[model samples]
Target: GAGVSQSPRYKVAKRGQDVALRCDPISGHVSLFWYQQALGQGPEFLTYFQNEAQLDKSGLPSDRFFAERPEGSVSTLKIQRTQQEDSAVYLCASSLSFSPGMDEQFFGPGTRLTVL
Candidate 1:
């Protein structure tokens, strides 16, 4: 079975440019998560999906950021008008638990975005 996969392992974006990062979760996974990791900092939750529903998005930093899991398997995180502060590793994870408190998520390698 394929594990979680994220595209453009690295990306360099100009300030104010929009960027889209992609993720592919494990087969049959029902839960997905998106996180942002700044240099030397632990990942912070951004959003989460259960199947095709976005169950939680309280962690999204701003209105400029958006994410979607169309069919419960693949997802995308779109950042509009990228900023220097947005430079970080965008990580995607997938799990099987309906309750986030009980799920053990498997993470992707992550897409590193650098804003210049």
Candidate 2:
């Protein structure tokens, strides 16, 4: 892909339902990241991957969330038992550099997940 792309740009999930959002990053990018943004707030990092290696998942709010990049290019973020607090815009970004200290991430438009 030429840039990061996320599917289901808008999603409405019933409370306690499970949802999966997908991201396709730019070609040959070495770093991928996921973030969550509640309305009126800045993005908060959820996880980061260096190629296929998940380096950080410190920002995921709870055990119900999981993410993977099985092939180092496309990624999925799955939320189980979604709560109203889970409603937010999920963003995916990719960078040419794997290192956090040097990478310049390019972000997608984001998937807006709403839990009711």
Residue-by-residue lDDT tens digits, candidate 1, 27-115: 88899999999999999999999999998999999999999988778999999999999999999999976773777899999999999
Tell me the whole-model lDDT of each prediction, alpha carbons only: 0.95, 0.94
TM-score for candidate 1, residues paired by index: 0.95
Off by over 4 Å in 2: none
lDDT tens digits by residue: candidate 2, 5-112: 899899999999999999998889989999999999999999999999999999999999999999898999999999999999999999998653877889999999
- Could you say which candidate leads in lDDT? 1
Which lDDT value does model 1 have at 16?
A: 100
Clash pairs for candidate 2: none
Clashing pairs in 1: none
- For candidate 2, the TM-score is 0.95
lDDT agreement of model 2 with the native: 0.94
Cα lDDT for residue 93, model 1? 96
